[model samples]
Target chain A: MQILFINNDGGGFADQIKIPDGTTVSDLFAQRMPGRNASHYLIRVNRQPVASDAVLQPGDRVSFTPTRIEGA
Target chain B: MRSASRALLRLAGKIHSRVESLQPTCSDLLLPDADWSRCRAAGRRLEKAERRGWRLAAVRLRRELRQAMEQLRLEMHRIEDRLTASERPPRIASLREILDDLRFLPDSFDEVRWDLRQEMLSVTTEPIVLEGFPLGRFTISLDWTRIGFTRPYHVLAREPNPAASDEAVTHPHVLNGKLCEGRGAVSLRAALESGRLVDFFTIVDRILHTYHRGSPHSPLSEWGGVCCPGCGDRLSEDDLTPCERCESVLCLGCLSGCPACRGLFCASCLEPCAECRVRTCRSCLSSGAGCGSADGSECFDGVEPCEGGRAQNRDSEADTHALLPV
Candidate 1:
């Protein structure tokens, strides 16, 4: 299955990635960013916030935004 | 006519002329010493003439004096009207009129532009310098008609040269590079009406400064640098999660997430399932029991029940199964 992944780290990079069936948001986060703390970022599925245990459907638009971006 | 009678008539005419001349100085009538000595002298002369067999001349003098006094009273009224008119403040019927009356922009703003069609005013502010942050220029857009009615104006900032360490744009009152202050339009209107453009800018500066000083690791970060609505705890620039349904800023303790849909909810909004110990929304429960139960019988929580005999509970213990960051 394929899903749209958007990372708001730099340039708001967005792309489609292939994932196995029954994969949760936390699993995807671990695969993408292994060492970073999951609590540091806000994870959303299809523009709606979801828990780390939320099951991702095929074609789901997943976004990972930092809880606190550098701001003045 | 007798000599005394003729003299009384002449004195009466002089008193009338003197009173007429003092019409312009009606305001001076209220003073301690005014130029009414000639009128007083004429009255005395008329009284003596009447006692000395000039009764008809004295009567004529009294009539003339009364006429002059009536004219002077009218003149005082006219002067009062003019003075009151000049003292009244200029009437402003609309926001455009107020802006038009402004002679110059405040020093904090670089430029101001108005769009009559949209009833919007855009102000570009001078570069704002904050500690440990790049110089930023703020652009504010105010909807003149709705400024103090619906919501406060929108604010956006642009940094010329962003810091290399963390390039992601951020603001204390900003979410996704957009200002999200929970202020009413009344405050903005008050600032504009009072001509306190500097005060408005000061408020923006304070929001940015507070956000810059906040630590992202704390639970206060999600509050957008505002106090929590529930416990009144001041929130910093950390990851305070807002309620998913209503978007109310919340602290970690105040936020509750549904287990079935995995959506975040506020303390007052969270509902738990009766059959399974999962927090579910009313809509989710109504459509179908998302708890993957086969029978779908008697699965109601007491917090918020669906159309059927379902009951829901807003139990915080359900947080153990919630999938939120906290």
Candidate 2:
């Protein structure tokens, strides 16, 4: 039931990480990064939109992509 | 007998001359078109000229054959002369030392990355005003720097202010409702040092909230920086990810949306969600029933079905393998 979680801009080296089974996409993001808000990131499960409450199944893959904020 | 032989040879020579005379000249055949039918038709008008070519060639061949016969006769009449000519001079075999001299040739030169260093210099510093919401002004600095062999370009840096109760303008980690303000000079320097320069043009869409009603000049984007396709924000090279499925190379800002199935995909290769119609990676295809063979449509486009043009064709398997993967 291991799930693969990857973040492009995770601020650290582990761009790809494996989470335990039953881990949701939202959960993986929370575990990998403690303080960062999930709302700020565009979290996708298996290439589809998923709610934060949705639990991840075995073999599920998740991505944490950040939304662009504009400034000088 | 010699006279009759000469006459026969002369007749042969005449025929050969006629053929040679009938042949087309190189200039006459100047046109690139080599169609035999057109040339044949044209040859009707050029029968005499075209015949010259064959005649000349035949005459040349016959002359050579006659010369050979004369030579044979001479050899038979003068055996001593033939024997004397048969002796050959001894060959002086020797190895050349020129190759040894070539060892002194200079080796080719190339440059290594470590040998090069990037230099950064601040060009200008000034305060920039943004009249948009949560309205405020910040100090912006212009920097010009060169990276390796690349030409130098300009970058804009803005000071960050960390919001704190003490408001000493000294703290680095203060949040002003997602926009920290009033950070100290040292912390601000650190933030500036860490901050990456992004393109102003690409992220202009995001700054739509800040556009003034009657501004004469449009916002300018930084040159040579990669932009996020999704939000137009500038992305650092490391943060840039190219999608395997759709071939969209994007920054973290616009990295979502699989090109194949419109499914959400991350910078890393991950499958699309089961609930969504967006296309995901090859690994996740089996889990989603609709994918791979969803609604009976083909999972992959551009590739022909099992028995189309490529299926019947052979000898192209190597070409197909090379093209499809990339």
Candidate 3:
């Protein structure tokens, strides 16, 4: 599955990657988030950001955002 | 109800929900399918060790999750603090005459960042000028990690402006925090050169004093006047003593004789005259017999003030006495 991570916030970073079978959103987010700060990150599966309860499948794009996003 | 308060309550609720959901349940860390099947085989392999005890492994697992949660709390607090801190004003905005001197702050930090990068490139780039004063040349480096974690919204660092750093390194008098012996200018210039770690009281003092002079809101009216130490009016070098005292502008108003010490003193250095019940200049008073400290404390026990001048008891005494209203 192709996963796309997009962080639109200023001072943000993003990446796109292909995931293997049975990769949960929580697992993907844990891998993506920085050490010790992963739990604080808001994980979004696909285009819709969701809470940790959301699950992920093959071809899912996951984004991790530090809760506060700045505009302008 | 007020719109802002309602919005704030909504924000608080969302934050509370997010924080509560962060705690992991038993199945939260569990892997599915292949990972679980492989884990079963691994567990079987570890069965011999498990016989000895799975207690250590369970303890390690629990400890790891607990540590992660602890880290999460700290990160949440830092984010909260940074967000709230922005709502408060930048302390520098309150300095007197500071904005007037600089006009407008750079609209964006882009130019500053670019300049800092370019200066760092130059093998011989002189220190960048700050607040019209010069500083010694210094190196610049981007602290992306610090910017990432501590203050995500803004680029923050202790990097000095080129001119100010050049002046500091070149001039033997200045340091990272202390001011040089000039007009002192409300200590704003010093605080500005210092990266974000501004001294709060120094800025507050300037703010209060600035307000005292005239406008409570204006930052430009906070100057202590440069007056003569001789006549008790604004000091003029042509026919006055323009000596600076304790980094503040010494005006002619405070100049007088110390009754006990009889030394020619500026108002800052003067004490109440022993003979006449009025403030006397330190330069006109003797140090011991009963002269007080610059702050008017009668230190009878022993410690004398450093740097005293001769006490003048001439006909100037009558003229000095005439200045203070009886």
Model number with the top TM-score: 1
lDDT of the structure predicted as candidate 2:
0.35
As for lDDT, the candidate ahead, 2 or 3, is 2
Each prediction's whole-model lDDT (CA)? 0.49, 0.35, 0.34
Docking class of 1: incorrect
Model 2 lDDT tens row, B270-312? 5543434444566545443333333233433533322222222
TM-score to native of every candidate shown: 0.27, 0.21, 0.24
Per-residue lDDT of model 3, residues B15-116, tens digit only: 233223332112212222443444455445456445667554544344334433333433343344334333332222122223221221122112322122
CAPRI rating of model 2? incorrect
lDDT of 2 at B314: 32
- Which stretches of model 3 miss by more than 4 angstroms? A7-11, A46-49, A57-61, A67-72, B1-271, B280-326
Better candidate number, 2 or 3, judged by TM-score: 3
